[model samples]
Target: MSVTKALEGAVGWLTLNRPDKLNSMTRDMVETMAAALKAWRDDAAVRVVVLTGTGRAFCAGADLKAGNGAAAPQPGEKDSLDVIVDFFDTLRNFPKPVIVAVNGLALAGGMEVVLSCDIVLAAESARLGDAHSNFGVFPGGGGAALLPRKVPDNVARYLLFTGDSLTAAEMKTYGLVNEVLPDAELTDRARALAEKLAGKSPLVLARMKRVAANACDKTTADAIRHELLELRDHKRSYDIQEGLRAFAEKRKPEFKGY
Candidate 1:
């Protein structure tokens, strides 16, 4: 399998499994991951998700040597690039939080994956960059578009133009990474963070994600209005009432996720 799926408590773990290839994504890997995300989307048992890879790399990007896993498209059929784009759309729109654990190298399409995710935790040894320029290939993913939104314009330009890698610590300083840990501690720390998120009200978390995403491109006034509308709708949810009741009883809220 090019991708592996596992359930740990309320966290769903999706691992890129082709370490021999630096975990580069193939069309099959993208499809498999999309299917898993769809399955976990509505699964009440799964409240959080973690995406990572095996071996020395998180993902080096698409396998250029394999023609990026492209196959001839039949009439009315989508090709590899379409498949890759759709998978990224699914990931970005996932209701539950998706955390990325960067264990090593993440370049090109791999860096785009990090952009789509909700949070990123990296190992001290991890390195990330846009290597597409080096090979005269333009990024078809979020690398060209979303990179600037995540970091300063200058930083994005540096990565895009130079095709040089940045240390996990350096990326953190640029706001691309949330936390960095020792390589030996990366997996455990990521799992612990996922477990912590799994304890929250799934409904609340989903709403928060939706509202935040919606607000990102809006003006302050529009964003406030949007947030207010969402809050108004959320006031009627069972989770809200349960949370208040639990607070009154001085106990942990047993959120049912509405």
Candidate 2:
């Protein structure tokens, strides 16, 4: 598979797999990512996931050069969650924390994938953008929704309108980048973050994720009420009691996903 491979050890590493093409995604790669992420979502060992590239670029975008078989999508195409459907949607709503470790350029659909990640740490030389607009399509992935949530409206609009790439420093200023490191340190930094998150209680993280996701869509009164309900439900989960006991006893909590 041009998408590269494997799901193991609580850390699923998805390398775009086609470095020669700047690791641009092929239909196969997209499919592979969707399936792999889904598998990880429910895996007990997996607490954090990482996406990266194998070579010069993280992923320059969808592979235009992919030979005709499954076929390449048109520049301005849309379907009712067609073709790339599973690929984009899976990344967006994945319950577990996903991290994008950009070693180089991440453009168009590739950049869209990164935007869906819970966190992003980039190499100092990395280039990230939504160049699909330049090719005449609105971002088919979650860029339209994800970008605005991560940065200022004006900044998101600027990139959407111009289809320009942002440097690591510039991207950091806009707040999408959680951390930045030298090229050689990209994997290390990503692994560090993944390990830290993986050590947390998955049940607590899940509930926290629900609250965070919900708060963005509700009023303060509704949010508070929702949170109370969440806590009420949370009490039934073992992780909550473990967390509390751990806090009181001054020891690490052993989270059993309840």
Candidate 3:
């Protein structure tokens, strides 16, 4: 399959497998990932997800080289933006954190994928940018809006306006990445982080993710004001009681999705 979806240990790695085109996304690949992520949200065994791409380019964006979709983007009978937006929202609201293990060049739409991730670990030699402006379309893949929120406004503006590629080191200094590991170590590092997150209580992680997201969101103040109320509700949840009982019994909690 062009999308390699696999779960090993506490982590799920979804690799964009089309290295021939710099691991670019096709509609099928995007939808497949969205579906997989949705399933993982409910699966207890799957705690963390590592989204990456194969070879030298993390993703060359929307596979422009193929006859169907081009860099300049010819008008199509197809409605590409809608499905893509849905998937983007799925990432934005993901209950569990997603780590984007960026190992190479990630341009245009690929930049949106990274922005959507909860955490991003880039390879030391990796490059990132939004080339959509250069090609003529407003970055429908969420770069224009999301990137600035992810990083500094000036930096985001500079990248969007100039279409300049930022190096991994620059991104780290700009607070755009969790860290930058060596190219060979990027996957392993991302897996380690995923495993670390997976070790915690699933319900707690989910609630905490929502809380943290809300803190950074437009509703930060109201969310914080009502945080304890939500936390109290979470504590009364069946999973919370199970977690405490499991700890007391020295056993793993068996959650029943209540």
Q: Judged by lDDT, which candidate is best?
A: 1
What global local distance difference test value does model 1 have? 0.93
Off by over 4 Å in 1: none
The TM-scores, one per candidate, come to 0.97, 0.90, 0.87
lDDT of candidates 1 onward, in order: 0.93, 0.81, 0.84
Considering TM-score, where higher is better, how would the candidates rank from best to worst?
1, 2, 3
Residue 122 deviation, candidate 2, in Å?
A: 0.5
Model 2 is weakest, by summed lDDT over 10 consecutive residues, at 64-73
Tell me which of candidates 1 and 3 scores higher on TM-score. 1
Return the candidate ranking by lDDT, descending: 1, 3, 2
Error of 1 at 129 (Å): 0.5
Q: Which stretches of candidate 2 lie over 4 Å from their true place?
A: 67-81
Tens digits of lDDT, candidate 1, 1-258: 999999998999999999999999888889899899999997999999999999999999998877744568998998888888889999999999999999999999999999999999999999999999999999988898999999999999999999999999999999999999999999999999999999888999998999898887999999999889889989999999998999999999888898
The CA lDDT at 233 in model 3 is 81
Q: Give the clashing residue pairs of candidate 3, or none.
A: none
Listing every candidate in turn, what is its Cα RMSD in Å to the true structure after a full C-alpha superposition? 1.1, 3.4, 3.4
